[model samples]
Each structure stands twice: as structure tokens, then as C-alpha cells.
Target chain A: MTVTAKIDVKNQDISESIRKLLEDILKTEIIQAILVSQHLPMKKMVMPTLVTDPDHLDGIDPLAPAFPVNAATIAARLTRKPIGEKIAAVLRPCEIRAFIELVKLNQAKRGNIILISVDCPGAFQNKDYLKFAGQNPKEATLRFYKKVMDGNAVEVEGVELATACKACEYPVSENADIQIGLYGMKTDESILVKAQTEAGDHILKQINLSATNEPAARQTAINSLITKRSSFRDEMFLKTTETTNSLEKISSFFASCVNCYNCRVACPVCYCKECVFVTDAFNHDSFQYISWAKKKGIIKMPTDTLFYHLTRLTHMSTACVGCGQCSNACPNDIPIMELFRTIAHVTQKAFDYQAGKSIEQKPPLSIFCKDEFQEVVGIND
Target chain B: MSEFEPTIVAFFCNWCTFTAADLAGTSRLSYPPNIKIIRVMCTGMVDPQYIIKAFLEGADGVLVSGCHPGDCHYINGNYKARRRIKLLKEILPQFGFDSKRLRLTWIGASDGIRLAEIMRTLVSQIKELGPSQSKLSMVI
Candidate 1:
């Protein structure tokens, strides 16, 4: 049975309450470690940390409103092999989805892990997070949480949340074992936590928290957020599709790409031991470049940018979770996510597939039905 | 430009479609000579990259032929190819290339006449569509 519980809040510090919960969880012999974002003494940035000791949980900050990396990659690393013990990981919705994709792809195993996801209030871009965070990130997080939880604009000093976050529709994770909910809850009095899986229920029993039913207001709040984000997502898809619906336009759309491949690195589901783009196949002969230049009069110096993206589109669209990390990592500030999400939306729909929807759903390419897409094979009756 | 003849790239599977093309040649069956056949082990082995590369390299049309359903030498290779080609067709139109430029056909080795007829039909379709824009680019 799904168990709903509360972690009472003190001093109106949501992050501190979360940290205390993690510390309590870590202090037990139940989970060997808890994966979370924590402030290190060396830098102001909150990086993913594996807290084996209860003392280390003091720096835990899942509400920092800064996403430097998709923490699913970290979770995948922790869960890839049999590490002999389980780990509790606090992640965002996208991260859990990406981790699930990794598990499906055989990049990670699901045995020794418990996914703890949050009601993502969304995050700012890396630089913008630093600027908005100012001197004390803890206070900034509290303020950020207060603003977003109240359904106000999450903008700080004219800066706003990252485009991916603003365009995000899936703010609550469905695949997580435990879902921490700050949305539509009286956070100053208490925070809501739902044990979404058997593992989550077991953990709540161990913690000795009283059970409660999911509040009706939580559902209403979540519905409104989804409605707001879906409109944004559809508008983005239409704008991106219109601009990139042709070869010349697609080329021009990616014209600013220097082929640095930051998007590939940032992509969570783009797990290939040897990427086709990095192989000797793309390394053209020096004479071939000169001949191509001679033929076209003047070709783009760093050619194959469009080809690289198209190849990725063909490969990963079925697995893309629309996390917006590609645009987040682009050095040239290209809205790479918009194009990918646009095409992925169409491609997935054509196959009647949703990438990373659940572990039970097989990837579209990996399975097939006898009667799907008959028009492509000219089988019209 | 008035006498434009489309250069078609045909990826024929070694087991079924390749033999069918060979049978057509042996039987002296007449078909368009525009096709440049590249033999592959199976249709499943035909990467979507090859199709994209063919278009990028200025092929007016592409035809991928393999054994009919339940006749694949590799059990379900043709089924996999069907799904991949279907998705490829769906995406090419978004990039301004007509999905008609690519065709996936099923021709058994015994059906040499069907193979010839399919080739004629594909060539005529391209003739109606005119040369692909990839071949008519100002730089190309």
C-alpha cells in the first residue's frame, strides 16, 4: 500500500528538514549511503555527494534550485554493478527518468537503489543560479522555495528559471520510490512525503512516521502546474518545428554549432561506449575537405554539424526524455532542447511510444508489431 | 535539366532481393538502368545512416528490398528493418525531404518479374517528382 507521511518543519527551512531526514536515514543501518547535493567547503556550488556518515548529511541541499548535472548519471554509476548495499538517491524528475532509461539500456542495474524524487520547483541556469544565490545559498534556497511554493514567479533580480525548467511539464516524478512534495503543502507547519513504492513504504515504517492520505490540494496544484507547462511546451514545439522543417533552415538553425559536443556529454540517455561521431569515420581526409570546398565554392569549415545532430536524432529520439539538458549545456546558448524535444515528440508519437515512461514499456525500436505503420511498406489495401 | 534522369540507390538484401535482382538480369527482364545496387547481408543491417548518407550525397531516390514477412533468413530481421524505415520516413519530411524519396519493398528471390516492376514504378515516381533538391543545389 502507498503510505503518505509528514516531516514536520522547524524554522521554515525546508532544506534543513530534508537534510535532517537524510541524516536520520543515514544514521540507521538500513541504507549504506544517501546520494544528494551538498555544499563542499572548497566551492559554493552544491555537487552530488554520497553521504556514508550522518555528519556529512548536514550539507545536503536538494532544494538548492541549481542543476549542474543530471544526477541520474551518478545514480547509474552507483547502481550499475552490485555494490553489496543499497543507496537512497534524492533526484529530480528528469534524473529519475534518465536513470530508468539507463537501467533499461543495461547501463545500470536496479537492485541496490531507492529513488527519492522531489516536487521540482525548477532550477536556474548554472551562472544564473550562482548570481541569484549570492552570498548564502541556504537562505537563497529558502527564499526560492517560499516564492515557488506560493505559486509566485521564481525570478530573482530579473533572472528567471532555466528554459528547460520553465518548459518542464513533469514536475512530479512517477517512477521514484518516495516522492517528496512541497507543492500545495503548508511547508512551515509540515511537509508531505509519499511512499510511492514498496521500498518507500518499508522506509517510512522504519522511520516510525504516522500515515496520512494524499491531500486534495496537492492534486489540484499539480494539475495547474502541468497545464501551465504543457502550453509552454506545445508553443516551443510548434516554433521549433516551423523553423527547422527544412534542410537549409536546419543547417542554419545549427549554424552556430562548433561541434564541441557539450550536448552529447550532457545527454543522460546518450550512453554509447563509442559514439559514431567521435570515430575515424567522421575524420575526413585533408584532400577530401579541399575537394568539397572546391565543389561548394565554400563549405562550412566545421562541416557535419547538421549530420551529427540528425544522426543523434535518428538514434536517441525514441529514448530522449525531453529533459532540456542539451540546451543547458550548449556553450553557444543554442536552444538544442527545443529542436530535439520537437522532433522527439513527433517521432515518439508516430511509434506510439514515450521514452522512459516506465521500465515495463520497451523502447520502440527494440520491439515491433506485425501491423504497425503499414503505409511505410506500401501495404495499402 | 530537361533530360534529367534520377540516380537511384538500391540496397538489396543478399538472401532474397539480391537474388531476385540477379534473376531479373538472367531472365532479360527489362527495368530502368538508373539503379546502382548495393548488396547488404540483411535489411536489418541497413543503418538509417546509409539512407541519410545516400540522400545527402545527392541520390534522387532510394529503394530498400528484403524478403517478405516471415521469410527473413535471420528470423525477424525484416520486421526490425520495417520499423526503422518507417521511422526514417516519418523524420525525413520534417527536414523538407519528401518521405516518397525512400521506399521499402518486399521481393522474394522467385519474384524476378515483381522486382523489375517495382524498379520501373520507383523510377517513374522520381521522374514525376523531378530531381531531388540535393542534386540541384547551386553549390552542388
Candidate 2:
């Protein structure tokens, strides 16, 4: 049986309790640093900060609605080579999933990291978050979490959750070594903390907390959220498919692309060390551009926008964790996440694969067998 | 009023399918002139980008034919190619490229007659399917 415990809440401040929990985790002798999102004091922007001293935990707020970047990329950086010390990372469900994909790609090592995920309430896009936070980020975070925990609509002010978050089905991470539960709990009383793996159990043993059982209501709450999100996701898939079903339509869908390539940079699973699109290979000869323009009668300058997106779909769709960072990073406001997730859903399902589900499951394209997918072979079909 | 001769780009594996094409040519087994074969070391090296580039540049059909499963000169290149083909079939169709426009086959070096026959059949099949969408409209 897994160990489940509760951290007492005073003044009904769940974030403060979680901060204290992390502070305690940081105090543990085995842990060298704890990586958690913090409101950087100067700008108050929520970014992942590594903390070695427990006193630096004041600005830590993993519950904030700000997701400027997927911390999986950061986690990959920390664990790419052994840091020689154990670190605990507090990540969202999607970040953990993306980190898992990075681990499978051999970009990240899990040997010295403890993954601690909470019941993700989802996050807003970067622009929407800045608007939502306005002058008081910490207060806005408190309001956001309270409204979400109250089981009301996510729209607090004029802003709603990012489309990607609304359509996400994974509100709870199953792969986390330790999970902090907030949904369906009496947050005024205490929050749920459970050790899901042997690593988590080892860490939990070091922390002094009273044991408790997970409330039956937690499962029900998670199920309802999943149902709501799945329906939204199905609707999104249909709409995205309609908009991008044809090549012409897909081109129009990305018509505003300036080839900034910010989306790929923001993507945690876009695993290339250096993308070919940015390399000199795409720098065509003057005559090549002239010929291309002459052939089409008029070619769009800064060519290969559609080609880039399609190539990315082929390369990264199977590894996509539906983090929606692509859409967040788009300067053109392209619904890149919808297009990617719709295609990713089909691609992953075609291979009977779910990206980031487990480290043990090899990436679909990495390994092949003698007798599978024969339906794709032969000219007769 | 003229007949539509679809342009097909074929990536034939150097050891097996490319040799088969050469055999067909020397043996006077006439395959349609529509197929422009690019010999590669293995179908495994025919990255998805190459196929996508062909389609985007208005090639009506793409074929990657290599050694049979256990007969790969590289001992598993054909298998890897099959997985990539399967991936493309899943991805390309989502954006309205008829999945039939792309094909994967296994034709051994000695199967010259078989290679020529399959090419004719593939050309006819694509001809019936009409020109690919990329050919009919602007891709970018």
C-alpha cells in the first residue's frame, strides 16, 4: 500500500502549506536542491527557480496560472548530465509527461531527480496570464486556485483557461513519484500528499507527516473533470480537423506564419539539437526563389512555412504531451496546439502509443518489428 | 485532351529495388516512363522529409521499395522504412493527401519482372486517383 498523508492548512492557504511541504523536502539531507516555480521578486514573473536553502521558499507558487515555458525543458537541462546530487522538481502533469518524453529520448536522466506533481488545475497562456495577474500576481494566483477548487467555471475575470488546458484530459499525473492532491479535498483542513513510487516512499519517510487515506471523493472529482475535458477535446479535434483537412485549408490555417519558429523553440519535445529550418540549408539561392516564385506566379516570401509545420508534425507528434506551449509561443496566434494535438491523437493512436505515458514504452518510430503494420506494405492495397 | 502521365518519384533501395529496376531496364521489361527513380543506399535513409518534399513539390505519387523484411542488406533498414511509411500514411492523410499516393513495397534484386509489373500497376492506380492535391492547388 502507498503512503498517503495530509499537511495541515492554516488560514486556508493551500499554497503556503505546499511551500512549507517543499521547504521541509528541501531540508531533507538527501535532497540537494528543490526546483519549483517561484514569483521572481523583481518582475513577479513565475519561473522555475532552484532553491538550496529552505528560507528562499517564500515566492514559491507552483499553483500560479503563469506557464511562460514548459519546465520539462528545464528539468531536462538539470538532469541531462548527472548533477551528482538529488533534486526534487515540482511540475505540472504536462511538464512531468514532457519530462518523461525527454527522459525516453535520452535527453534527461531520472536517476537523481524526484518528480513531485500536484493535481494540475491547468494554466493560462502567457499573454492571458500577464493580463490576469495585472498588478498583483500572488493575489491573482490565490483567486484562480480558489475559484478552480470551488468547482466553478475557470473564468474569474474576463480570461478563461487556455484552450489547451480546457481540453486537457490529464488533470492528475499517474507517473509522478509523489503527488499532491488538491481536488475534492477539504483544502480548509489539509491537502493530500501521497508517495506513489519507492523513491517517493523513501523521501516521504524522511519528512514528518501523519498518515491518512485518500478520500473517496477525490476519484469522483478527477473522473468528472476528465469527462468534461474529454468532451471539450473531442469537439476541438472535430473543429481542427474541419479547418485543416485539406492542404489549401491547412496552408490558410498557417497563412499568417512569418517563420519565426518560436513554436518549435517553445515545444519541449521538439528534440532536434539544431532545427534544419533555421540552418543555412533553408537559405535558398536567389535563382531558386525566383524559379519558385515564377512557378507559382507569386510565391510567399520566407518560404517553407507549411513545410516546416508538416515536418514538425511528422517528427514530434508522437512525442507530444499536449502541453500547448506551441500555441502560447506563437506570435501569429496560430492554434498550433490544436493542430498538433489533433494530429498527435491520431498518430499516437495509430501506433497504439501514448506519449509520455511511461519511460518503459519505447518511442513508436524508434523500434520496429518484422510482422507489424503489414497493411501499409505492398502495392495491391 | 492529352492523357495524364502522373509524375511518380520512386526511392529504390540500392541493393534490392534499385538493382531490380536496373534488371528490368536491361531485360527490356518496359515500365512506364512516369517513374523517376532515385537510388538510395536503403529505404531506411529515405527520411519522411524527402517524401513530404516530393508531395509538396507536386509529385503525384511516391514509392519506397526495398528488400523484403529479412533480406535487408543492412539487416533491418526495410523494417525501419516500413514504420516510417506507416507513420506517413497516418500523418499525410490527415491533411488530405490520399494515402494511396504514397506506397511501400518489398521487391528483391532478382524480382525484375515483379518490379516492372508493380510500377505499371502503381502508375495506373495513381492515374485513377487523379493528380494529388498538391499538384492541383498551391501548397504554400
Candidate 3:
């Protein structure tokens, strides 16, 4: 028989309960260190914090609206080498997926990190979050939770959640060892707790929290949320495709790009230590520039804008996960996420693969299949 | 009047296209002095990034010439290059540059005349298209 568990939130605060959970894990040596989210000092923004001492978890608040960066890259860095003891790291669903991809690429290790995920309520962009917090952070956090648990999308000062969150289909972390459920539950009542893997089951058994069947209301809430997000994603895909179908149209779509490369930097899977664009490979001599300009009569300053984007698409499309961090990081607000997600959707589908879906699945380019794309190759004999 | 000349970066496989280019020179066949060939062991070693980098560094066009599909010196390098170049063709144009600026062809070591003909054709085509400026790099 499957077991479900609940925590009564009416009698206790969610943040305090989470702190206690981490404290217990720290004291028991299950995790040598714990990484949690905390509000920045004198600011309403939340950021990732690593804490080895349980006392430092007092200000940890994972429920804040700010998602300035994905925590997967952090987890990858933390586990790049063995640290002698396992560390527990909390992340959102997308972050966990990104981390898994990084691990498969040999950029990270799983032996030294404990993965903990939470039922994401979605988050706001950084600037909007600060405005929402205004002069009082506690009230803003309370309002944010109320809105999210009530199934109403939370907004920060009228700006909606980031496009990434609005279109996210996975609110529950499927790969997490320990999952803290928040969606589809009463904010004033208990939250659900579950173990998804052997590691999680072992930890839960040690924590000794009695299991109970998840409430029917919670299941209904979760189903409705997933359905809502799925439909939104479908609508977005259609709209993006219709707007830009060909290369010329897509180039116009990105005409505002100044080649800041923030999108590349923000991408979790773009792990190149030295990108070709930054090297001497793209540097052109002054005479070459003048000669080209003289020939063409005009040139776009700081050449190779289109080449830069095309190079990145070829290199990173296979690993794109539609996180929208690229779009979030853009100073020009280019719809880079939409373009990448659209192309990646088609490319990955053509290969019958999904980025970051499984560790066993090799990237399409890394391996060759004799029967792959036979029709396109005109080898349909 | 000065003749229209094109600056082409030719990524030629050592076994075939490079030899064909050398054969063209040895046969004294007249071809446009437009192409500056970079010899690679196999066409598969010519990463799409390298082609893009060439264009970014002011090469008006790039030609990736390798052995015939079934005749790659490295067994399957030409086939792999074909797949990669095909994908690059599909994707490069989306960034506002003409995909024609990047070309791929097969040339055997015996096909010195064909190599010269391809160079002449590419130089004329690039001249017609003029210099590639739309795909130029942007400084942050």
C-alpha cells in the first residue's frame, strides 16, 4: 500500500517547520551541510544560502517570490568534487532537471549531494519582487503565499510571474529524493511530505513522520494546476511559432539583440569555460573591417551578431530546457527563450529525446544511429 | 577595372578536396585566387563553429569540401560532415544571414578541374551577394 503524509500548518509556521527539519538532518550527520533560501539583509529579495550550522537557518525562507538564478549550477559546483560528506541542497523542479543534465555531462557529481525539491509556487522576476516587497517583506510574503495557495497566480506589483513559471508543466519535483509539497494544500493547514526514491524513503523512515493518505482536495488541486499550466504552454508554443516561422522572420524577431550574451550566460547547460565567440577567433583586424565596410558601404557595428546567435543555437539547443532564464537575463528583453524553446522542441522531438529527462539517454549528437533521419538523408532504401 | 574577388575559407579534407586543390595548382588550371584553404584530416573535424568563426572574422563565405560520401578516407567522416552541414544550413539562415554563404561539396583527388570550377562559381556567387554584413558580431 502507498503511504501519504501531512503536516498541520494551522498550528505551526511552514518556514519554522522546514528549519526544524533541516536542523534535525544537520544534527544527525545525514547531511554535512544544508543549502537553503534566505531573504537578503535589509532587502525583500531571496537568494540561495549555504549553512553548515543549524543556527544560521533562522532566516531561511524558500517561499519568497524572487528567483534571481537557477540553483542547479550552484549544486553542480558544490558537487564537482567529493567533499568527504554529503550535502543537502534544496532546488526547484527545473533546477533539479538542469543539475541532472550537468551531472550526465560530467560537469557535476551526485555522490556528494542530497537533492531536496519543493512543490514550486512559481516566482517573480527580480525587479518586480523588490517592488512588491515595498517597505514590508513579511506582509508581502504572506500575500504571496495566499495568492499561490488560492490557485490565483501571484503578481508582484501587477507584473505577472516570469514566463518560465507560467508555462512550467512540472510543479512537483519528480526526481527529488525528498519532496516538500505546498501546491494544492491549505496554507493554514498541513502540507504533504513524500519520499520519491530509495534515498528519500530511508531518510523519511529515519525522520519517523507517520504516513497518511494525501487528502482528495490536494490531488484535485494538483491536477487542476498541471492542466492549467499545460494549456498555457500549448498556447505559448502556438503563438511563438506563428510569429516567427522562417530564418528571416526569426532574425527580425531578435533584431534588438546587442549580443550581450546574457542568454548564453544564464543558460544552465551552457557550461563552456571558454566560448569561441570570446576568443581571438572572432576578433577582426582594423584593415579588414574598413575594407569590408568600404565594399559594403555600411556595416553593423561590432560585427558577427547573427553568427554568434547561430553558433549558440547549434551548440546548446540540444540541452535547452525552456527555463526562460535566458529571457529573464536579457537586458533588451528579447524573446530568446521562446526561440530556443521552439527550436529545441522540434530538434529534441526529431531525435525522440527530451533534454534533462534521463541520465541514461545520451545526447543526440554524442552518438550515431544508423537508422536515424534516414528519410532526411535520402537513404530510405 | 579591378576584378571582383571573394575571400573564401575552404575547409578541405586532406584525402580528397585538399589534394584536388593541390592538383588544380599542379595542373596549372586557371581558377579564381579567392579561396584560402585550411587542410583538415577529415571534414568531420570542421566544426560548424569553425565555419561561423571564419565568417565572423571577415571571410565573405566558407566552403566545406570533403571526399564523396562513400569514399571518406576516415571511413564515415564525410557522412557525418554531411549531416552536420545540412543541419547548419537549416539553422544558420534563421539568424538573418543567407545560408548560401556557407556551402558544402564533394571533390575527389582526381577532380582537379571540378575543384577549380567550384571555386570560380563560389567567387562569382559571393560577388553577386556582396559582402556579408548582416551576420556581423555585436559588442555587448
Candidate 4:
């Protein structure tokens, strides 16, 4: 049976309530540590930190509107090998999805890890978040979530959420072992907590919290958010398709790229240990460069820009979780997410598959049926 | 303008299609010379990057011919190749590559005439499609 409970809020401090919850979880004998986003004392930036002591939960800020990096990579690292202790990870919805993808790829194991998620109100880009969190990041986090939960305007000081977040259809993660709710609840009084798995139920049973029924408004609010986001996503797809429908247009779309490869690095599902772009294969001889230039007469220097992007799409589009980290990592402010999400939509649809949707579904290229996809084979047929 | 002779890059599986090409040669079958054959151990080994590079480097068409289903020497290499092709067919066309430019076929070793016939038809089909847009324009 599913266990639904609430964390009582005092003094209107949601983060504190969450911190207390984490501290309680950490205090449990079953959980050795907790992985969550926290503010580093040295800097205002929030990053994923592993906390073993209950006292360290003071810095926990999973509600912080700062997504510096997808913690899935961190989760993968922690759970890649058995550490002999269980770690509870507090993650955003997209991070949980990406972690699920990593698990499917055999890059991570889920044996000793419990995934916890919150109803994501969305996040700002890195630059915008820095501006949003001027002096006190903790206060800024509270302000952002309060406004969102109150059904007020999301844009504060002319800055809004990231495009990926705005277009995100999944504000709630159904796959998480435990979920914290804020979309349609009286946060000033209490917050919702639900256990989705047996492990989550076991943990919830240890904590003394009053059971409650989910409010009807929660599903309605979630539906409205999804409707708004899906419309935005379709519009984005239309615009991206118009801009990159041809090779010449695609070249112009990525014209500002310097081949820094930050997008691939930022991608959680791009699991290659050694990308061919950085290998000796791409280290062409001087004569080869000259010959290539001589043939085209005016070839773009730092060549293979288009080649690199197309190759990446073919290699990783099926696994792309539309996390928007690629656009966040680009120095040139390229809308890399728009193009990737657009193409990924088509590629995933062609296989009737969705990336990060389920653990049972194998990756498109990883497994294939003998008689399937016959439409793709042969010329006359 | 003179009649267009499209340059086709054919990646044939060594166990099947490559042997068919060899059989065509021995049988004195007259196929179009526009095709440049590169024998791979299996069609599954023909990475998507190979097809993308050929298109970018000015090949008008690419063909990945392997054994028929269940005839794969390495079990299900051709099946894997099919999914990759289906994926590329969805992506490359979004960037203006005609779905016709990329193909996957199953030609058995003994079907020399069938292999020769498909090549003639492929070359003609590509001729109808004209030169690849990437060939006429600069790609970097």
C-alpha cells in the first residue's frame, strides 16, 4: 500500500522543513548518507553534495532554482559500484529520469540507492540564477518556490525559467521511490510526502508523520502545468524544424560553435568514455587540412562542426532526456536544446520509444527484432 | 548537361552482399560502375557516422546491403543495422537529406543478378533525385 504523509511547516520556511526531513532520514540506521543539492560555504552556487551527518542537512536546498549540473552523473558515480551502504538521493524530476537512463545503460546500479523527487516548479539558467540569488541564496530559493506555489508570476526581475523547464511536461516524477509535493498544498501549514515503493514505505514507517489523503487540487494543478508546457513544446518544435530543415540552415544554426564540446560533456546520457572527436582520428595531418580547404576553397576552420553535431545526434538522440543541460553548457548561447529536443522527438517517435520513460524498455539501437522495421529495408518496397 | 552519373557508396556485408558482388564479377554481370564498394564484416558494423561522412564528403547515395533476415553470419547484425537506419532516416532528413539517399537491403550471395539489378535501379533512382544538396553547397 502507498503511504502518503505530510511534513508540518513552521514559520513558513519550506526549506527548513525539508532540511529537517532530510536530517531525520539521515538519522535513520538504514540510510548511511543522503545525496542532495546544497549551498557550498565558499560560494553562493548550489551543487549536489553528499552528506553523511545529520547536522550537515542545514545546507540542504533541493528547492533552490539553481541547476548547475544534473546530479544523475553524481548518482551514477556513487551507485556505479556497491559501496556497502545505502544512500538516499534527493533529485529533481529530470535528474531522476536521467538516472533511470543511466541505470538502463548499465552505467549505474540501483540496488543500494533510493530516489526522492519534488514537484519541480522549474529552474532558471545558470546566469539568471546568479542574478536571482544576489546576497542570500536560501532566501532567494524560498521566494522563488513561494511565488510558484502561490500561483503568482514566475518571472522575478525580468528573468524566467529555462526554456527546457518551461517546455518540460514532467513536473512530477511518478518513478521516484519517494515524492515531496508542493504544487497544490498549503505550504505555510504543511507539505505533502508520499512513499511510492516498499523501500520508501519502510523509510516512511520509521518517521512519525500523520497519514493524509492527496488533495484533489493537486492533480488539476499538475494537468494545467502539463497542458501549458506541451503547447510551448509544440511551438518550439515548429520553430526549430523551420530553422534546421536543411544542411545549409543547420550549418547556420550552429555557426557560432567553436567545437569546445561542452554540450556533450554536459549531457548526462552521452556515456562515451572517449569521444572520437577528441581521439587521434580527428587529429588530421596538416596536409589533410590543407587538402580539405583546397577542395572546398573556403572551408570553415575547426572543421567537422556539422559532422560532430550530426554524429552526436545519431549516437545519443535516442537516449536524450531533453534535460536542457546542453544549452546551459554552451558558451555561445546556442539553443542546442531546441534542435536536439526537436530531433530527439522524431527519432524516439520513429522507434515508438521514449527515452528515460521506463527501465524495462531497452534502448532503440541496443536491441532489435528480426522481422521488425521492414519498412526501412530495401529500395522498391 | 551530360547525363548525371551519381557516385554511390555501397557498404556490403562480407558474408553475403560482398560475395554477391564477387559472383556478379565472375558471372560477367554488367552493373553500373558508379558504385564504390566497401566490404564490411557485417552491416551492423556500418556505423551511422560512415553514412553521415559519405554524404558530407559528396557521395550522392549510400547503400548498406547485408544478408537476408536469419541469414546473418553474426546472428542479428543486420537487425541492429535496420534500427540504426530507421533512426538516421528520421534525423538526417530533418537536415535536408532525402530519405532515398540512405538505404538498407538484403541481397543473398547467390543472387548475383538481383544485386546487379538493384544497383542499376539505385543509380537511376538517385539520378532522378539529382545531385545531393551537400555536394553542390559547402559543408563544414
* Candidate 4 lDDT by residue in tens digits, B116-140: 9999999999999999988767886
Poorly placed runs, candidate 4 (over 4 Å): A150-154
User: What does the lDDT read for residue A364 in candidate 3?
Assistant: 65
Q: Taking chain A of candidate 1, what TM-score results? A: 0.97
Docking quality of model 3: it rates as incorrect
Which regions of candidate 2 deviate over 4 angstroms?
A: A150-152
- Judge the docking of candidate 4 as incorrect, acceptable, medium or high: high
Interface root mean square deviation for model 1, in Å? 2.6
Tens-digit lDDT track for model 4 on A1-381?
678999899988999988888888777778999999999999999999999988888887899999999889999999999989999999999998899989999999977799999899889999999999999999999888877764345576678989899888999998788999998898999999999889998998888788999999989888888888888899999999999999889989999999999999999999889999999999999999889878767788898999999999999999888889999999999999999999999999998888888889888889988679888888974
In candidate 2, position A379 carries an lDDT of 84
Per-residue lDDT value at B65 in model 4 = 96
TM-score of chain B of each: 0.95, 0.98, 0.92, 0.98
Per-residue lDDT tens digits for candidate 1, residues A229-340, read 8888899888888998877788778878999999999999999978988899988999998887776476776877776888788999888887878987999998898888
Report the C-alpha lDDT of model 3 over A1-381, residue by residue, as the tens digit.
333566666444676666677787777777788878887786667889999988888888877777888888999999998878889898888888888889888899876787888788788777677877777765576677777775557454586888778888777777887888877666577777777777766666666466777667777887888888878888887888777764456656777888788888889999999988888866778898888677656666776676677678878787787777898899988878877876777667666777878778887667664434433332111
Q: Pick the candidate with the highest DockQ.
A: 4
What's each prediction's clash count?
0, 0, 12, 0
A199-314: candidate 2 lDDT, tens digit per residue: 99888888999999999999999999998899999999999999999988999999999999999999999979999887898988899998987776777778888899989999
lDDT of 3: 0.76
Per-residue error for A68 in candidate 1, Å, reads 0.9
C-alpha root-mean-square deviation, candidate 3? 4.4
